[model samples]
Target: MQVETLVVVPVVLVAFVFYLTHNQTGLPRVGKSGPFGFILTALKSITSFADLLDEGLNKYGSKAFVVPTMAGSLIVAGPENVDLFKSSDDTAINQPISVDESLQLMHTLNSRQLALPFQAVVVRTDVTRAISAFIPEILEETRLAMAEAFALPFGEKSTTLPLFHTMTHLVARISNRAILGPSICRQEQYLHDIIRFAETLSIYGQLLTWFPRILRSPVYFLLSSAFGGPKEPARAIIPHLKMLLAEREQGLENAKTITDFLINLAPPEEIADVKLLAMRVLSVNFGSIHTSSIFGTHALFHLATLSESELDTIRHEIIEALESEGGYNKASLAKMRILDSTLREVGRFYALGVVCLNRVLIKPASLVDGIVVPSGYNITIPLKPIHFDENVYPEPYKFDCFRFSKLRASDHTDLKYGFTTVEKDFVPFGLGKHACPGRFFASMELKIMLSHLLLNYDLSLPGGAKEAPKPIFFNSHVIPDTKACVILKPRVGQAGQDL
Candidate 1:
């Protein structure tokens, strides 16, 4: 009787799932008819959605039907949709559902009020004004931090290191300088703790995202309590920020940095929320450190592995720009066309996230001629296909640093899409309003780090080591494999050129 009950229960559950799925309405017709048949086909195609999108785009042109998962159907539009996605009418497209686990993880590190504080901070004009006002000071701090970080271990007797580790330290120092000011930024322990906090938060968040929403908070509490809670790493720095906030509040008339700027924007009622301010500081650190470091590492790796002639060309450009402009200001950095192209190429080839922009439909909408995406469906542009498309980027697999350079030389103009300015065919920093606001600071940080590294060190793969670093692909994200190494030696005659 027990064996029969178990067998019957399994059969009944399967039948019920099939009945609910088939009876459900709004399943769009694709290359076939009938709900169950189409769903079965989609289930088989789920693992190869990237390939399916590519095939659909090639065969049907610019639009394709995809099942976001086994249960959801979506119609994806191509690059033309970028503009549509950016416009006000498209604001109806909801923010993608964050994994409950990820949210719970964030909650552990930050209060609910702090973790999801009005998106206005990122998407509105007031924040833009604050950022613009802060850029010059931010750049200055970044330059000083870059110099100090590289100058360490003193005499510089050929220090070779992993790209990620080098970048993590450099970015942490630079970001801390901008976010927390020089006194705190220069402290080694503070920087290390911030990185540790970010790493821990990301791991917990990723783990939690796989579970159902109802179970997330309890899971987070259990895991965090067992795993040393957010306070473990945060303890080193939170008190300092609170003290800084208090000092700024008491001396409101004299404060001059970003913390001051943030304070001024707050109302009297909001001024006392030190915990909320600390969360913002931590969020800024997480965003700035991880993405900037990853991209910077990729840029340096590409530069180190490229041929000497290529390296010389970029170096010459940098020197000429510095000589003409007197230093690495925004204008001078912009003039380093080859460096820009190389950076863009690395971002393009590496393609930050396998899936680029993510959106959740808020209302049922017809995308193209015959495809409809129901409300609540999640959608993403699979960047790999677009980035790797041969038609868009000829010989897409090969690293051609000159790819964008050739285009610029021919057109005599930087690439512009309406009001958006971008280069070549890359969108690593993303596009439109949702684009990373910290990219300017990130660019400055990368340029300073790379400029110093190139001017002072000779770098290469270890003897007989493979020419190029191998990238490990995990769930569409590409990261340099841990085994890769580069050798660095002090530049013999370049000591006098240090600035």
Candidate 2:
């Protein structure tokens, strides 16, 4: 009467059914075409799928399938589909719910409530209106941030430092100035707390995604309480924000920055929710710091590795722009075509987000060629394939600092360099209506940081380190491997030039 026989029978039956269905379905084979192929396919795809995805796209044209995880299948859409998917009119087809979910998970861990303040205040506007109100405040903060960063230790060193860490600190300072204004920006502890809070939340958010919903809340509380979670930072900063809001209400009459805009524009419901405001401030910091830092490092690293003459030419362009305009401003920075091209090239080569631009199919749709895609199938664009295509960009592997500049030079008609524009071919800031709204501020931040670094320091790889830093890919997103070091040294005569 042992129960062993009963358990074994059901287990065997289930296995047999799985085998039959897996074979009969004729769904895309992920790895080797054999029984139980999905396991091997998933392993292979995750390990080196970028190259494999590219190869599959080359062979299959517009639609190919890759098995990135055994949990689900990835539908690799072609360039035409990329255009359609990005510009999709249907909500389900272009859902932003995933990002929203991630934000909610962050809120749970921090024990903070969620609010959509940004959607009401910022994302509702067209680009022109958004930029007009925000750009000047961003620029003013950029100057203050640059001055603060240079005053720190290793601030004026000519020796190379760790690029990612240095850039992170610099961007944090910049973001604090923009989001919190000058008084809070000068507080060292507040700046440090913001950086720590962002780093902690990112790790926790990733963890919560893999666990069951019921377990997330309790687990988050345990982890966050053990570590100094968002609560600690919120506790410290909430009082300051309240004071700031009170001061503003009392007619301080400062220039209308993001903080002021959010306070004034968010719906009463959202404004009453302090947690939502905190989340918005945190979101801005998270978006601005990591992204601008990566781009800033890439641009600096490329400039450092170039030959002396190339470096001199770029330097001359910077000096001329500065002299002509008498200083760095939005208009003068825009005129530095060489630097623009260099930054664009860096973006093209080192885009951090990989294959996970998820869109849930809203309706039965077909491509121009009549390939039918049923509703509810998730569509994803593999950024690396588009970025590395030899047809789109000749000799895609070679890092030509002037690649975009050359394109612009040959065809001044090409408007890829314009700040507010986006395209399928170049999507570092993403594309369509949901594309990053803060790119103008990001561009100014990168330009100011680079302009300051180039004018003040000489940078290079450590002696005997022959190669530039290479990126390590996780899933599909590419990140600079932190193990590589770039040395920086202050220029001899340039020490006090700007000071």
Q: Quote each prediction's TM-score.
A: 0.78, 0.82
Q: Report how far off residue 124 is in candidate 2 (Å).
A: 8.0
Residue-level lDDT tens digits of model 1 in 1-499: 6999889667755654454244232433243446566556455443455555556566656664454334345445565455445542444554423222233434555544333543225423344444444445555665565455445366656556666776787778766765667777778877777776665565566555434444567777887787644555466556765676667658745544444445555544445666565555666677677777777777777777777677777777778877787766666667677766766777778855556656667676555344566665555555656678799888998877677777777778764321124432456666665566666656666676676567666677766352467666533356665556666775667632443
- Poorly placed runs, candidate 1 (over 4 Å): 1-80, 88-91, 96-157, 200-203, 226-230, 252-257, 267-270, 414-425, 464-467
The whole-model C-alpha lDDT of candidate 1 against the native structure comes to: 0.59
Quote the positional error of residue 496 for candidate 1 in Å: 7.7
Q: What is the C-alpha RMSD of each candidate to the true structure, in Å?
A: 5.7, 5.3
Best-performing candidate as measured by TM-score: 2
